[model samples]
Target: AERVWYPLWDAGLKLGHQVGTVAQLLDVGAENLETATSLLAARVVAASSADGEALVDDLAERALAQWKGRSRQNLDQLQGAVAERHARFGEVAFLLEPDIKEARGGLRDVHSLFWVEQATVPILREAESAGLAAAFEMLLEVRVELHRLTGQRADKLLLELQDDVAAALGLADADVLMAEVSAAGRTIAWTGEGAARRTLRASRRRGPMKALSGIRRREVAPGLVLDDGRLELTDDADLGDPLLVLRYAASAARHDAYLQRGSLERLADHAEPLPVPWPAEARGLFVDLLAAGPAAIPVIEDLDQVGLFVLLVPEWEPCRSRPQRNAYHRFTVDRHLMEAAAEASRLVGQVERPDLLLVGALFHDIGKGYPGDHTVVGVDLLTTIAARMGYEGDDVDLLVAMVEHHLLLPDVATRRDLDDNGTIRQVADAVGGTVLLGLLGALTEADSIATGPSAWSNWKAGLVRELVERTSHVLGGGDVGDVVGGSFPDAAQQALLDDGTFVVRGEGLELTVVAADRPGTFAKVAGVLALNGADVLGASAHSEHGRALSVFRVGSVLGGEPDWARIDEQVNRALAGRLAVAARLGDRSRTYRPIHLTARPARPTMTVDNVSSATATVLEVTCPDGVGVLYRITRAFAELDLDIVRAHVQTLGSDVIDAFYVRDQFGAKITDPEHLAEVELSVLRWVAVDF
Candidate 1:
């Protein structure tokens, strides 16, 4: 109790001249009863005169009016508050283990619905009240039980506690409990969302606005219309046509138009069920909707909110808001599938079969809700879904294959050696042929990009592309040698003979340094560059014929143009071993937090490949990224007296995947297993450090 009111009391002491006593504090609160109500409701004053009591009553009446009345000022304030809350909790439904109080569709949503209902216009009062009430009651009960079982103030319904909570609530199983909770959350969330929409429309009606010229309308067939920025139905609309729903959805998606709430409600309550073995037009429109890319997300969300999507695809229920229970996935299973399909739409021109790509993306995770291997189970489910959509036998076979191996590209690209002929051939055999391979490649990119930022990096993309090209080469009966030959540019010799080159490119400066090949060339270059107040974004290095060429992509750390002459002088001095690059870089590294040291385990991996190139041993490194990581890596190599022939550096979120081609002092490939192990251990240890 003291913790709750002490701040108010402390403020009173600061603001009031004589607020040391309790009675004096109450007097101060009574004089400013509105502030008191905001801080500690209703009990601010111990007793009051008749006139003071009447003043309090009047204040209460005004406060209620502000909350419940539809004045322009009140509605505007409400809108701002709603937007703030949406930003805070909009993605709560997708959490792996959601908080019962603060998460979207949780207890707060129920309260928000009540507040919105109180302020809604009369015509929109009972739009979905029954569902809202039921959801409120169920969530209140769960919240109470959750607090009791945990013997404290707990709101997150964790997986470990789900079974116990279910038993305590007299439920049959945890799944039943979770489904009930999810349903309640959705009900409250949808109702609140609908209320907010109505309030915004009401607020707009009072503002001075001009109607669009010529009664703008984009007709979807004969009845449905995008009229004046809202979806509507004409007088002669056919509610019995199942294809009308898909047509309207497709039109709204393609045109990026908002659907009217009333029209959505009518469709949800009265739309005709789609026939089994659905017609070609219906399936085509569904594909068109998916092909709209990210514009379709809003339409799909609106349909799901109004309960119309389930009527189109009943199999969607299991995947709705289903948690993936991993850090890598950012959305629920159904949302992830839709996002993947949307992402695939952006690459429609890249594939021979856009329709198949859309279908495969939508059904990629349909088996996640079931037990056993999801790939095999998803293949079975895809067969049924395809048949229901009236696909031909050959199309069904293709869809099954697509779903059965959706994870093939990313899994193989990241985990296997793409340089191996057997690896490329294995992918080709699994993919069947060149055409299917193309589709799989496109689908893989869409799926990975939609997974999360960390799931796909430039380096990973390059690896996947390489794998695909090599596989294509093999499939076309081309020699591996023909596909793997490219020469480094002669820029190094020119730069060595003169000054280095610095050019501004897209918000950063690209510095090209050329010098005689040495063990610590990269270290000196990176260190001297960092010492000049340059934040290195990326870099690449290559050395051949006793000459080294390096390019550093960097942005100014001090928000000004880099002093090119100073940078050039320092870099040269560092390369000549006159400057202590390591000590200088170490000093600068202390300003930034040691984020990588405390970061989640990166599962650092090292692979020494002797087959990729005959001349140099390729050391592929993957680990958590950090400030000055590249410097530490190159420094470690310099310490070991290993010359880096080439280096490729890439970062995806916090993870860094790099490859370095190196040789011993004698210019021989480090083939001995014991020596390779020592090198791998050294690199991994340096990578694990923050500086």
Candidate 2:
């Protein structure tokens, strides 16, 4: 094929005609056959005929006119078409691994914008077109390289292939490559959306009701006006005023209106820089903008796109479009920060200083764009950032503490034994007081919810809440033991224990098992729940005298409500040793093996912590999640003759971090080094079992 086309391509190039690859030719042919045919005819005639110059010009004009006519005819249907396209391939601009061809901000969107510009009057200005073209070329180059590397027709930039693609493009790493992709994709998507909106407005202005809709305007603030549903500066507005930008952004966000592209460009070109140690009014406006919640996202996005946001916060430049590169994060660093701030806005009523909360949430992950531990770096960054934003000493310190401890609550709640007194005291000491603790608590939730779905769950939230309550008690001058001790066997569970009878009850998604305190009690219940298709999200165990109480928070594998009756009956049989739980689980695993194990699983890890709790040994296990994982791990503990005091199970993406508070058969912490090694080995062996 190359031999046949090489001479023709050379002749066409010599004739001063542009040439593209076979794929480009196929794309043009697919989009419009007449245009493709006309271009081909023009190239062939110019290359083969002596009088082909004049004929080529006519064919080119014909193709241009055809495109212009099509654009004019389809102008009314453009918005719906864009929406349909977005519906098919999602509209998020910051997908960790994105499709370069068909995604919302991908090449297709750029094409749509090009078509829009070919209408009766161009929708995009010259500068906008040039920028969009550059972004389009960047994405196209990446897509081509991706196809070359994979040796297949590929578009989606998968995580596994990112590093190789980056190297092929002479980029530093996958993060750098993805950051470029993100920036380009965002440019295209933003421009395409603006063009579509302008097209709709232009079409409306030319309709029969044009006279009635003639440029409705309202002055919304000192220098800002709402013109035809868009926010823009008034003719007399002062661009020299440093506070104007913040006021404009805050007003646009609060009113939930679009920022006019012309106004945005003017501001980007002429707006003054905000003074360091911003004035109280400027700070207020910034907080008000963040207080707009989800509505602030698009407004801030527009500012970032126009290079206005970075001008306000110079430290924000590195974070723009920075990829998080993990399954746990749903957005880039900057976007996640904005989303976290937005989520925090909903809980403003819960915090003492909403301003501090809003600012803290926005800057919690700012240091992620830098080196070193994000928490430690974040503290140093916020110390200066907050001060520049007009915060006083106390406020600055509070914000710094917020950034430093943003992950503390969730980390402790999910991975540590919350019932441990040392755990509660450590959190209290770190938090310092109720005021800072409250800010961190709200920030933790907002940060987790913004991170991703798997980052926050009911079980995890419950644990954090329990931790916060215990920490708050200590900060409020109450005894730590009062909060952490002797509260498990509440009146109801104690009455069941007082009767000294085996009782198993299942209600909705909760299962409670009370029986004689034994080594295998927790393991037996976990196995029964797994066998019954109940996913154990969390569980806790407590024993008073010779009786034990085990409570499980569960969900069905197939979703909806759990079958409590069947689960209850199975628990009875398993606890009584009548059911073969292990054999049954093995058979189930063999019948319904996971299809997602194609990738090698991470090596399982076990950590024995005797320092966190004074009364029990804490075993933290990290491994890939599976159906019978909990059963296997707990079964190991039971076989080791360890008493299960409490268990905290948290599933993060494909992995689970399960922390167990265990004791020796004599109800003491396991302190022997050899015994600890044996415990770790047994758990690892059980976790690696196929069943």
Candidate 3:
């Protein structure tokens, strides 16, 4: 303790003498010292010969004076420091456990205001200052309580400790404590960020003529004008316009610009509230803001900073700046909603009611802050809000349905059997019609993208699109056969076939095989390609009227160019029963092991579908992709006397998703449950064994 006091005393004395006054000693830590857990408590004793009490009193006055006449450079230095701290914190609202001191909009932001005030910087005006001071006090109390509970200088409000801290603070529970903390954090962060913006604005060269010369003001909407890239009020606008704020927000979003701070302050002061059932223009503007895609994020942030978002959607308060204590999210509930809306905006053209999709996206997860399953809670909350916004009858129902079943598409696509007629019918019936199906499909993508990268993949996207298309057919009152019979090769791959008679395009050896359809066409072609030292990466096979057009994308297994002439001869021999694919592949298997096994293994699944095609049973085999896996599966089909009609093979990273459409003898769909089970079992055995 004495060692600590000696250094502080020496530092204070040196700083006091250098400033040439005892009153110039500034103590930034004193204001919150009583609540500080880690700061050492010490007293500086003076010599018995000196006037100790008088010297202390003089030091306080000089310290206050040093803050009063700060130079321009000093103010800039403070701004830079705050900006550096802001960068260090990054976006923390959605961190699984947030640091209560250094996180954005946390105690540090509140402390920055004290520094700003101490420097006599007038960046924060009267209203912002009042708000910030109250927020600072709240955060300071939380920090003090946290330190007391932990018995250390702990600042991270981790999930496990939140309940304990809440109990110590006399709060009802952790949720209530978190709500209060989030509110304070949002206020402090928003205020500090506004001040930082203003400081940058203040540092710019100031001259009305020079500002005007850069970019003149232009009217963007009825009551809004773009004043040098920032939005502001036009001279002819009515100050009391109920829709004025929303209109300006929409215009700013559309142009990828921001609302001027002065304009925001003016709007906050005078903008009138919309009627109970919001007018057409207000609702339209809300949709427009969402439709602006990524451009809307900054505009929404500006609205939130200026308190306009809460005014527009009063229910937004509990969620604003709220931390999501989960690994899946990368943003707070409010930020995630904005990002979802932006992503939905990109897919708006896909839906019939883009406006409803936009609104639904904006409020999809509004119930995360409340208790219960978010989907159920969100449906009730968004329905009420939609009703208040003047949506009625089918429109109100549509919004409710959208919220309730937002996760329907992705869930069904990934987990359920998409090739079953019953599966497609069930989804179609649940979502009502094509309109809702389209909207739900778009919302699913938007929501997943906002959740995080791990929540989506190309394979997932392909699955969802297939579900949507099949469901659309059902809703259109078409039989399963229409959907099944119409399924064709991917348009891009079909184009690749028509461009040349027998072309091999890709570096990975794409071979276009055009031949008369036979009993083991796919097996022969695949085995020939394999024997020629060409490893099949993927293949697409299509057949019509005794003729087959197949494309195989292959890489070199032997690290050399494939012998095309030998491949042609072997394919013919295999078709003629003069070549054995199974025996040759079995020999090759002994030399190499599977290379692309997942770091975390998953059980291989073989799905047999009879409803996806009119003439063939669809077999989708998903497994760890490795050398000769395709050859083994094709050989198994040939041994089962199954004729391959079409095959779509795709490799996604370490896994292979290969769909083989096959017909039994007499070219009929295999509907017998026992036979289908046998086929699945056979494929599983082939996929499981090495050879």
Q: What is every candidate's alpha-carbon RMSD to the true fold?
A: 7.8, 6.1, 11.1
| Clash counts for all predictions | 0, 0, 4
lDDT (Cα, tens digit) per residue for candidate 1, span 279-384: 9998999999999999888788878877788788878877876656445666768778899999999888988888988988888888987778889889888888
Q: What TM value does model 2 have? A: 0.83
**Local accuracy by lDDT, each model:** 0.71, 0.82, 0.71
After superposition, the stretches of candidate 2 with alpha carbons farther than 4 Å from their true spots are: 1-73, 149-151, 212-215, 271-273, 415-423, 457-470, 478-487, 495-505, 514-521, 531-533, 544-547, 563-604, 607-612, 684-691
TM-score (C-alpha) between model 3 and the true structure: 0.61
Which ten-residue region of model 3 has the weakest summed lDDT? 33-42
Model 3: how far residue 248 lies from native, Å: 2.6
Highest-lDDT candidate:
2
Per-residue accuracy of model 2 over 362-445 as CA lDDT, tens digit each: 999999989899889888888888888889988998999998888889978877777679999889989999999989889989
Residue pairs clashing in model 3 are: 22-59, 23-62, 23-63, 24-62
Measured on C-alpha atoms, candidate 2 has an lDDT of: 0.82
